[model samples]
Every structure is written in C-alpha cells, then in structure tokens.
Target: MITPRFSCSQNEESVVVKIYCPSVRASDIEINVDDTLFTVHINPYYLRLNFSQSLLEDDESSAQYDPSSGYLTVTLTKAEKGQVFKDLDLLSKLLAPRLTEPPPGNPIIEVLDSDDAADIQTDEDALVQATESLTLEQNEILEAAESDWQLKQEVPEPLSSLRTSPTDRYGFLDSYSGYFTHVEHTENEVNELGSEAETLPKSDRRKHRIEHEEKKWDEEYYLADYADGEHIQELLCWRHPHLQLPDVSYTPEEELAMLNLPRKEYLASPLQTRQLYLTLLTLLFAYAYESRTTQHDPTPESGWTLGILIPAFSALDPPPYTDKSTNDPSTFSIEEVISTFVASYRRSLAFPLYRSFALAESCRSDVASFLSKGRRMVLRCLLEMKYILDHHDVYYVYSKIWIDDFCVWIQANASDETLHQLGSLICSLKIPKADIGWDLEELEALVSNSEVGREADSDDESEDEVERMLPTPL
Candidate 1:
C-alpha cells in the first residue's frame, strides 16, 4: 500500500492532518486513534503516524474529503487542550514508530511560569523587608559569611583575554575575523531540507534525500579542494590555544536550526551499532579535514554535515518490533559504509574555493584505494575524529554518541599501532590532498596553561584583598 502524501498543522486544541488520496469511497475509509498513534487506511493507501502527544477522538473529531481536489482532511482534538504540538510537519519522523521500549526516563524538572515567578518574587520581597531590621553587627556577620561562601564557590574558566578589541557580537572571535569571514545567512541547508521535506510523501522522502546526497559529490570539486593544501596544512600544524574555544556558541537562529534537525532512531544490534558509529566517525573526520581545506572553516557546513550523515544512518526507520524474529543478526555492508563516506566527503567539496581536474583520474584511484584499505585505515580515522571532536564544541553530540564510545572500544582492543603512530599515519594517509593537523600534546599544554593562568590570577586577587585588610605601618 502506498503511503499517501500528507501535511500536518496544529492549533491550540486540535491537529489537522491533510492526506492526498483520490477516488476512495467515504465508506471504505478506516480511521483509528489509540493514544498517540494514528492510522488511516483506504484500499490502496495506508498511513500510520506517531505523535509526540496523545490525541482524543470525540464528537468534535471530524473527517472531510474534497472529491474535487482528492484530499482527505482529518481533524482530531488534542488530549491536553492548549498544549502546543511540535514537529507536526516532519512527516518522516512522525511516520517513524516509537522505540520498542522507551529509553530510560530522566528526572522531571518543573518549569516556572509567570505566576510562579510572581509568587517567588513576593516571598523574596518579604525576606528582604525582614533582613532590613537586622543590626549593623548582624549584617556585617552575614556579609562576611556571604564573602566566604563566594570564595568557596568554583570559578568559571576565564575566556581568552588575548583579544585586544571587544568580542564580536557574532560568534566569530575578533582575531579570527581576518582569518574567516562571518556569513550572516541564518538558514542552513539542513533546516531547509527539513522544511522542504514537509510537503513530500513519506515514501518519497528517502529517495529525495538519496538523490540530494548524490548530487553533492563531484570529482572536479574534490580535486579542486585537494590541490590547495593550505587549509589542510593549517589543520595539521596549528592547534587552538584556548581551553574554551573562542566564541563557539551558536547564534539563536542557528540553535533553532539545530533543534529542528530530523531525529529518527534505527534498529541495530550493539555490534552493528558500534560499527555504524565507527563508520560515522571516519566520515566525520573526512568532513572536518576537507571542510577546513575547502572553506578555511568548517562552521558553515556543520549542520549540513549532520543533515547528510544522519539520514544515511536513519534512512530506513525500522518497523515496530512486534515479532521476536524481527531481530536479526546482521552487519552494515561495505557498500553502505563507503556510501556514507562518499556522502560526507562530497559535502565537503560542495562549496569549495576552487576545483581542479588535472588530477581527477588519480584522485579517483586514490579514493578507491582509501576505501579498499577498509579496517586497515580506520585506526587513523578514529584518531582524527577524536582530535576534532575533543576540541570542537559544536559537534559534541556526535562525540557523545560515536567518538567517545569508539575511543573506549579502541582502548579495550589494543593494536600493534600506538595512538601516536596512528595519529602520525593520519598526516601521511592523506587522500590526494587530505591531511589533519591536530596535536594532542599542544592541545593539552594550552588547556594546562589556561587553568594555571586562572589559578595565578585568583591567588593574586586573594593576596591583594588580604594586604588591604592588614593595618598600614605608619
């Protein structure tokens, strides 16, 4: 049965699902709503959707079909009125079944609304009025206690004080502005993919994504990016000297774009999952290294990288696991791994500063050889991913999901190649023009210096305060 094209929208009380299915008799339609799951069936078309919130089918629930337009519009009341529903237009995610068993629950924290804030303010005012009646001696004692408490509190790491001018309002550091241009385009290609996907049928979304992924790769672009090794040299040679990377926070719009990223879980055994993660790590390394070579900075394609790579992993949302036999012992195919790598690598070449065909034939051979090496080269790939994810703040989520676990796994399974050897091999294992420049020792020293500087400054402040408190010799 075809998954009919659909669109969803919501108001305070109800969700409107518009499905396009023509020539179906009204009597032939079957609509079922069980808690958060909704199913619609009409002879040749079927759709099952899972919503973030429970839905209610009551007297107010209605289905209207427009024979002229071949559209079926179903309106269902929300279980909790006035509750806002999110990601309604994300058809692919909505069609994906919930995990077989829910992930472990986290502690629930109550969010304070305006009324709660007002009540808290009233209590604070009362306490302030009561405190005003304290004697000067009591106030002094309280002040001293507060001072001690403040001193005991942990100090936050100091931001880089090296910038002579004020910090840029944008995310880029003042010093790095000359090195990189800060593009103000708020809409990233990834968020645009999610928005554009809303109108497509569930069946077509994956195909659309596959085609889109394929279009990102071009041999000429890759060779062009490969020819200029300056960015690659920079990546291989210099490490940022700051513990907290300068201005790593995403702008408000960028954060929203990230939050809007499509999230779909897939069914894979622990082993297959680890392999998938490893493959993703390698792809990430190529992307990080190539983006630096092509764009001089990786920030521009950050979301786009996630957009392409994540869909490859979650391309097919596993069906609801009702039967035990659905769990099969299988592994990710090499073709799939290579496809993911190509998808990631292609994106890095998409917006290059230049392109060269002089070595296209040789570059193709090099890419083929890189893939043929397989597990032989993954060690260096893993090391490269660790270096970038360790320092880069934006890809921290990937680090948590893939890189961190992969690191632990690598540690548990020691190989003949030491980390230093593998890291050095990463520089030599360049694909035509790809080499990484992350040094662990240099990064460690920078972090150490950052901490020591903070401690020295704190000690000096404490000493100055003590001297001021002491009596002056007259």
Candidate 2:
C-alpha cells in the first residue's frame, strides 16, 4: 500500500490540491471525484483516500495525474470566488462519513446561490455584504488552522511571553500558567459575602483561583516527554520534524511486553502504557500514509510486505484464562484489560481530537457517504462527551483512539489467524506531519514581567488584547 502525500494552494479563481506520489505515472493511478467527495485508488493495493465532498463546488472540477512529477493535481473551481478552504488536511479528519447532523455550533454558513442573489437590495449593500462574507470566510480558515475553542482555553501567547528558547524566546513559565495575580482582596470585600465566605481563611478564598492555575501540560514536560525512545516517539518526531528527534525503530519484543502487561501494572505505569498506545496509534496512522502515497516496499529482513511496520503486540492474542477454578484468580478479564487500555488512551489523545469533533459537530456536517464504515451513534457520543484533554495540540490524536478502538474490539473477539490481517492493516499507515508555524503574538506584559504584580496599564493592556495570538499547545 502507498500513502498519498499531497499539498494544496488556492487563488481567487480556483483551489488546487496535489497528491505527491513519487514515480507514479498516469496509468498507475486511479482518481474519483463527485459533487462532495474525492476518492483515489492506485491499482490493487490497500491504497485509497476519501475526502469530504462538502467543501467543494459542483462546477468544473479537474484531476491531472502526472507520471513525470508523480503529483496528482486536482483543481476545484471555488463555488464562490474568494471562499477560503478552511481545512486542507481533510484526510486527517477521515474516519467515516458521519450521520446527517449539524457540525459544531450547528450553524450552517449559508452560502447564497449566485442565481438567486440577483435581487440586490442596493449595490452598496451587496458590496458590504460581500466584503463581510469574505472576511467571515478568512476567519473560517483561521478557525480551522487554529481552533478557537483551544485559543480560548490555552494561554493566548505562552511562547511569546517566554523570554527564552533555543532562540532565547518561549522560555519556561508556570506549568499551569497565569498562576499569579493572587493578591488578597480587602476584608470588606470578603465580608460582603455570606457567612461561609466570612468564616473561610483568606488563603482558602483563593482556592478557585489556585485551581485555575493547575494545568496539565507544561513546556518543560513537553521538552522532557516527547523525545526519542519515548512512547509514540516515532509518531511525534516524524510528524513534527521541527522537533528534530532521532528515528526510533519500535521492535516486536518491546511491543509484546506492552500488550502482555497485567491490567493492574498497565494501569499503574500510565506513562509506559500511554507511550504504548501512542506508539501503536501513530504506527497505525503511519501505515495508512505509507500504504497510500509512496514507500510501498517492505524490507526483506523485517518480513514486512510493505514499508509500514506493525507491532508484535498487534499480532499477538491475549492469553485465555488458565487458572480457572471454583474461584477465579483474576478479577479482570482480557476484554476488561483491552477496554482499559483504550479508555486511558482516549482520555488524553482522543479526548482532544473529540473536542475538535464536538466543535465541528455544532456546525452541520456533510451528508455521509454510503462507503463510510463507522457507526454514527459512536461519533455523536464522542462529540457529546466532556472534552478534558491532557495535551491539546498534539495532532493524530483522534485517529489513534478510533483506529485503536476499532482494532482492539476486533482483536478481543477475533482469533489469532485474524491477527495477521490486523497487523497488515497497522503497517499500511503513512508518516504524518505536525502543525507548527503557529502565529505567536508577543505578550509584552507576561514576556517582560515574570511576576504578576503591577496591573497592566489600561491603554497598553487593551492593545495587548488585540495583539494576542494563539500559542502552540505544550
């Protein structure tokens, strides 16, 4: 299988999406396009891609596969000129076509039909509306690139506030940021409250404020946690080459040990287990990429059929209950063990992705294609769940949960023979890239002042709010 590598760009007239398939000639590829879907296939491999068609206009769309450059170029004329493509990474959100439901905010950005819009109230009104519409479209692009929900949740400019990095900027701050400004209120202010507040200690009065400061991920933790040989190190490092971590070859013996760990032990060593989940999940993703675009050759030494590699754990079956007696020795079963693994994995990684999904859900989604396989109910449940994330910025989080959950469920019910197929599927994913290059707004207040004491000047503070840009999650 070959992963389809691609890039996209757009102009006022058209949007161009290019699939980077090296050495692939015109005859070696197959392309399919419809009103709202884009599917690609390359011969008899497990290589395929289906994109949400909801993004495109039904006008003259063209696809050109060039053998010389190995780039599959698809040109979609914008339904409305100047309408921005909000999400070019449509493949990342791929899982299955969701049910006929609303996207996040459940608000359809009602784009008016050109023919029906002939009734212009006034030329000036039309121009103003058009300009506003264009601005809204640009905003949608920014929203897709940098999540508004995350923007509100994360410190607006943690890195810009830092006076240090390798570049002497984006240095470390409090892990749970915005920890200061804990000055005590006057006694009258405290006493203005009810007796519960009156009786409370001045220290305890700050509990709510203190709780807000306790954040999960920190710059230091990220620097320490996501490194070579760390769990899911391959996924993170490969995706974010900007991080410059050395290559990690996750071997079979190590993978087996992860799967074989007792439930209690697995739960106890969350880091090891988390790395295991992350590793497996990322490998699954990498396999998808490699299987579609390029790198279809497997090493003879490794016995892999394709370039993508599967874990030994993916191939092995959990041991059946051997110590069965009048009283079973273990309280947990193999099913429970696998479920727990999936649950903890979702807590941090999947949960974050689900937040995005939830937001998307509020807006209506495209009518799901008949080809999509996942259940509609499950997606809704995922969207509705309270999204408490550990690492908000890590990409490939959703696929890890969904793919891992799908495989784990199958593996639990499946026989050892089917394990080979599961393993093969895992090896078909392609390497993914990280979303860096985030817009960093300089926080003059936090950037210059380490301690939160003096109040920011009203005029200067007002300017800072406008200058504030979202940070890359730690």
Candidate 3:
C-alpha cells in the first residue's frame, strides 16, 4: 500500500508543501513562520519552518511537525539529520493520526432550561439598567446644552471663557471647579506680592532719580512772563511817534490828520501795528465787559485811547486793494468785509499769535455787538481771517481758536437770528462746509420759544379781534 507522501517546495518569500496519499487526493499548501499561529488553523493548513538550519543533529532549531488542518510540512532549510523527503514523510506520518482522531475536550453546548431562564432575566435587567442610565445621561446632556445656549445668549462672555468651558456634558462642574481653583491660586499669588511690596521713601534710589529728572526739566523749561497788551502798548509808544496821542483838546480834524500820516513814515513798523491791535482788542474787551456807552468821549483814558487806535492805524495803512470789488458799496456784506480784514491783518503781521488775539477780541461781548449788527466793515475783518485760513487749508487751526471763543460768547447769549446768520455765513465758505441746518435751527428755537419770553395776548386786542369776527352758533 502507498502511504501518503509529502513533499516541500521553496519560494523567494514563502515555502509550499504538497501532500499525497493513495486514500487522500493530492493537496498543496503554503505558510510563513512569522504569520500568526491562529492563521494556520484554516482548512488544509500548512507549516512554514525556517530552511536556514543544517540537517545534522537533533537541536532546538529542528521543530516538530504539526498540521492544524490535516496537512504536514517540514522546512528543508531547517532540517537536522534528515533528508527533505524523509522530513516530509516523518511530518506526514506524525500528523496523520492526529488528524484522523477527534480533538480532545471539544467544546460542549449544554441546554439548562432553568439556568438559561435565570441568565436571560439577568441579561434583560442589565439591558434595562443600561438603557435607563443612557436615557438619564442623554436628558442630562440635553439640559446642559440648553443651559449653555441660554448662558451664551444672555451674557457676553470673553472668548477665553468659551475656550476654557467644558465640552463634555458630564465634566462641566469639574472643569468649572478646576478653573475657579486656578483663578483663586493666581489671585492669592497676586495678593501675597502686593502685601510684600516695599514702601519706598522719596529718598530711595529710584524715587530720587525720578525727582531729579523732574527738577531738571522744571529748571530747563521755566515759563517766561506773558507779554500783556499794556506792555506791548508801552513798547509801541516808545518806538513810534504818530501812534502817540496829542492833548485831548485837539479837534477831530487835527486828530484825523495825525491818524492819516503816510503809511511809509509812521506805520512802517509791523511790530508796532501788532502791539497796537492787541491794545485795541484789550480795550474793546474791557469796554464791553463794563457795558460802557459807545458815545463816550473818544479820548477818555478808558475809551478812544485804546479803541480809536485800530481804525486810525487802518486808515493810515489801508490794505492793498483786490480786483474783486464790494457787491454793494452802500451796504457791504459783513461776511466779506470781515474776511478781507482778517486776511489783510494776518498777511501784515505774518504770525498767528497776533491774529488769534484779534479774533478773540472780536468774539468778546463788546465787539461782538459789532458782529451782531452785521456791519460790513467789522464783519469783513473777521471773515477775511476766516477766508485766508480756509483758502490756505489751515482752517483747522484758525477754527479751533475762533470757533471756541465765538461759541463761548454764543452760549452766554445766543439768538435764533444770530444762528441763522452764522449758518448762512458758514455755508458761503464752500470749503469744509459746516452742517448748520438742523443744529442752527435747534439752537435758535431753544432761545426763541423759551417759557420766559412767551406771553399771552392783551385783553383789549383779543376783544377787538373777537368783535370783528363773531362766528354764528352751529
């Protein structure tokens, strides 16, 4: 009888074995030793033995042949004292009996009706418990989600809070507690540092250094005495003669002649003119504040001495004429005249300091009446300054000084008519236009319809109108 014959073949990466027998059909199998043993448990399984060992004596390198699925294999590379064919034959014989007999202690399935019922009951209870727990967890998660949504909607929290907020529904309290603890620890550290801070005296090195630096700056930048209008007038009187006042008995013609001195002779000095302007402005402010009558003697110490100088100087040194003539010689526009005067004044002085004094004076209560009267001559001077600044793109600086002073006066005694006139004047600038429509109207209405100014019609006038139009009873 031809017993089953086994043979082995080798590939580059794996080994293959063939099993043949008179009773069994030929079968081919392949395996690798590095592969899991569980992989060889398949039907018609094969073993892969290392072929690097020499076949000489029995050693640890020689492994026993065991085929999990009725197949046998022996590696020629790992054979010891046996030929490849003999090793295969030995492996086949060793595995044949093991394959023919049933495996020992095979798993048995027992049917225990009573015990199965109990286990089923237990499993059902566990499932129900798990479901209940899951439902509770889901409800908790939903409630937490709603609460978080509400919090986000109600409060504007920082992004940092959002980043540190717990994402896991169950871990919210723990995360919040940890965050608070961390904050407390940080606060404690800050408090400890604050408590330990030293109370340094002014004599301390750092304090001394700061004090020294402040003292150095104070000494370096000491402010000089401000030159007042009176001082400037004195300086002018000392420097120029035509600017000097003759005896009060002089007639108006004599005074006018003195004022009309040639510009090249008496008004040649720009500095004297600026000083005179400042003195005139100061006097105007004093007179306005005192509410003095305009009809006062021109040569009074407190009257024309300061106020007449400006007009006299202007007459002596008239501004250079421009090609643009006044629209109406009899009643020149106040806005145009003021603009011309300011522009001429600025050009003549070549400095903003003196210009600011002139503007401030014009906005004062006394001279403010002049602006209020809408006089073409005075208004021309003010508008001239404004025009120069607007044309040169320096209106920001000019407006800062002019508008602030003007607003102060306006606030004290502003009228609807004044606001309307102001709006019209500002609108004429064309550049950097002012938004005066609603604002001006509102300011005007506030003053015009005030409760204190409102009054009921007289009884006699009311009766006379009533008799004129008696309505027939309906």
| Index of the highest-lDDT prediction | 1
lDDT of 3 by residue, 1-474 (tens): 122334445433233444432222233323333321111222333322223223322233222344444444433233323334322212212232111233656788887666578889999999889757777767777687877744335657666323333221101011111211232233221111122112222123223322322332221111111122453333222311111223113233322322222111121133333222222232233333222222222222322212212221111122222234334322324444343333323321221122222222232433434433432222223332223333332222322333222222222222335434533443342211122111323433454555334434466677889988998789
Superposed by TM-score, candidate 1 places the C-alpha of residue 109 at a distance from the truth, in angstroms, of: 33
Question: Regarding TM-score, does 1 or 3 come out ahead?
Answer: 1
Give the candidate number with the greatest TM-score: 1
Q: Candidate 3: what lDDT?
A: 0.30
Q: Candidate 2 vs. truth: CA RMSD?
A: 29.2
Candidate 1's C-alpha lDDT?
A: 0.50
Q: Write the per-residue lDDT of candidate 1 for residues 184-271, one digit (tens) a residue.
A: 2333333223433223333455566556545654554444344454554544443322111332222343223222323445444455
**TM-score of each model, paired residue for residue:** 0.32, 0.24, 0.17
Steric clashes per prediction: 5, 44, 19
Over the full model, what C-alpha lDDT does candidate 2 score relative to the true structure? 0.32
Model 2: per-residue Cα lDDT over 1-474, one tens digit each: 544555556777676777766665467566555544556676432223234334454457777877777667878766567766543332323322333443565666876676755465577687788757777767776676676444434557555343332221100110111111121332211111123332333334334212322332133332223221234333222321211223222234323322322111011132323233323332332233232222233222211211112221111111121222213221223342233222222222211211111111111111011002122222221121101111122212222333333333222222223233323333332211121111112222343353334345666787777678656569
